[model samples]
Target: MNNKLFSVIFSLAVAIALVGPLFAAGGGTALQHANVNVRDTAAVQRGAKLFVNYCLSCHSASYMRYNRLAEDLGLDEELVMDNLVFADVKIGETMDIAMRPADAEAWLGKVPPDLSLISRSRGADWLYTYMLTFYQDESGGWNNLALPNVSMPHVFWQLQGIQKPVYATHDGIEVVDHLTLGKPGLQSPEEYEGTVRDLVTFLDYLGEPAKVKRKNVGVWVLLFLALFALIAYALKAEYWRDVH
Candidate 1:
């Protein structure tokens, strides 16, 4: 009886120990790494440029229309045409990627994530952290899931530098001690953060294309209701004496 009780206690303790990190990082839910600064208009513009230059080739944001972006953002059609709009897509076309999913799985060992609803699905902080947290763990075979033996090689290693997550324990708490860049990337830390913020903004925009418009219209709707109520009250007062 004592041995059985010990086994149960041991199992419970092991389970708690194993699942602790899961809760800390949002309970093993979808990747929620992002530092999305949607309010930064300039940063969003910069991020759009960065994403077009780097990320658009693999992943497609199918829901967003170029025309929508232009109308909402007041973008110059000529500039987007010359610079950000690649793949021979028209100025009014929907955003899409050239990469096929089957080929991507063969190449990267997993399908690339869609960015359309990523901000909604994973949250901004998750996207931000994911962008920043990639590191070199030599054993990660194919797909990396904290399993050191990952096969997927770092695609952005050159841009972000080769990172290896430094692990440490203090006061019995394990942590991702640090991220050290072994090689140089195209951008510095501040530059990279801005870049990530840009992507986050874009993702946020994609997630809710009508958000800005809705917010702008919401105020007017409320004002209309208040004005309508005042007029209604005045009408009621004006009619009150007619029968009398």
Candidate 2:
């Protein structure tokens, strides 16, 4: 009944109201674990290569510089320029697409989104699941369980092959029970999964290049705080001993 108690209750209610939608949005299939490790330098390197080959033509990581990526992933400047640099861009330049926005819109009916911060916004698991769940619909177009009716085609179909969805009725509504490989691709399923994992790992790194450094520094900061706290406690006790 007091003003302070009423304010606390109102804050809690507002928090619940804001967070309710996130919980409600979990009605679809459970997201699979991405298991991305940004510390795996080889994996990130491979992911960077894959991104440049398959995704760079459409979606650009415009916020990230090629030289920065090389430094983070421990790649040589010349090697990056020779292999990863398809466009006539300098090593210090940002990863931008050559495709015009108008051309992309006309071709795909929508512009593909920039992926610099996609891992941060969508999470690694969602990206992993989205990458793997592409299936050939009855109409012969590509669809995904993670994002149904998406405009993006199965760009990795040659690597992952054709996947078909098994339908089952869920409360009188038909839904995909699971995906089965209808046709094998160039790589085995395990290989494809590993490739996707590597790509996701690279994306995770791109989202926050300083994440590992920050975590390492945080440990030292905590240790210093603990030591300081103990020292402060000892000083306080010594100062109060004579007074007591």
Candidate 3:
């Protein structure tokens, strides 16, 4: 019985491991391997700046509006328009990436991803870490899993400096350790890391643009549900007591 149970457990674990990531790969509502709390305002603002400068050329957060971001991030409309808004996108317009797939293919080979729901789809922490963890890859031509064989050059190199991979083997498991940022960029390592954090935060907000509303309303919703349940239980008790 013990051997049979072990065999079943092992088989189930192996099957799930093999098929799970494939099933869950592109489903929105989660970012890829990121854990995020959309409540962090500072992080979200930094993410917005990074998005406009580096990612806006290719990707678009089409579901969001500049005005909404300003309201959520506590920025004035003038500031958002002057600093972060791009390509003549009016303050009221949705954030749309101008690059079509064909256009992106012509240039960068893949359509830059839409990040509007990336937080939900991929998770914020995944974006946060991936943004910072890019390293020079001789194998894929550049090291990035979200993008492999990417024709797009490292856009953040000037800000992030360059990171080279250092490999360590433990128990036959290869691990990346303390990716060293070589040289200096427009932003120091600390500043660049903050930029990445902010970028991830913005993406997190995009994933659920109404997170604030949802969180705020959740308390009321729970209270109502609880009240209804209490009333229902009391009524049930009264009716059942007479029947009993």
lDDT of 2 by residue, 4-37 (tens): 9999999999999999756643427678898998
The CA-based lDDT of model 1 is what? Answer: 0.71
* lDDT, model 2, position 62: 89
Count of clashing residue pairs in every prediction: 27, 0, 14
How do the predictions measure up, each by TM-score?
Answer: 0.68, 0.83, 0.69
Candidate 3 segments exceeding 4 Å error: 1-36, 139-141, 145-148, 167-178, 186-188, 219-244
Q: Native-vs-model 3 lDDT?
A: 0.74
Q: List candidate 1 segments past 4 Å from native.
A: 1-35, 139-156, 169-176, 218-244
RMSD of each: 8.1, 3.7, 6.3
Clashes of 1: 27
Q: Which of the two candidates, 1 or 2, achieves a greater lDDT against the reference? A: 2
**Cα error of candidate 1 at position 186, Å:** 3.8
Error of 3 at 223 (Å): 8.3
Clashes of 3: 14
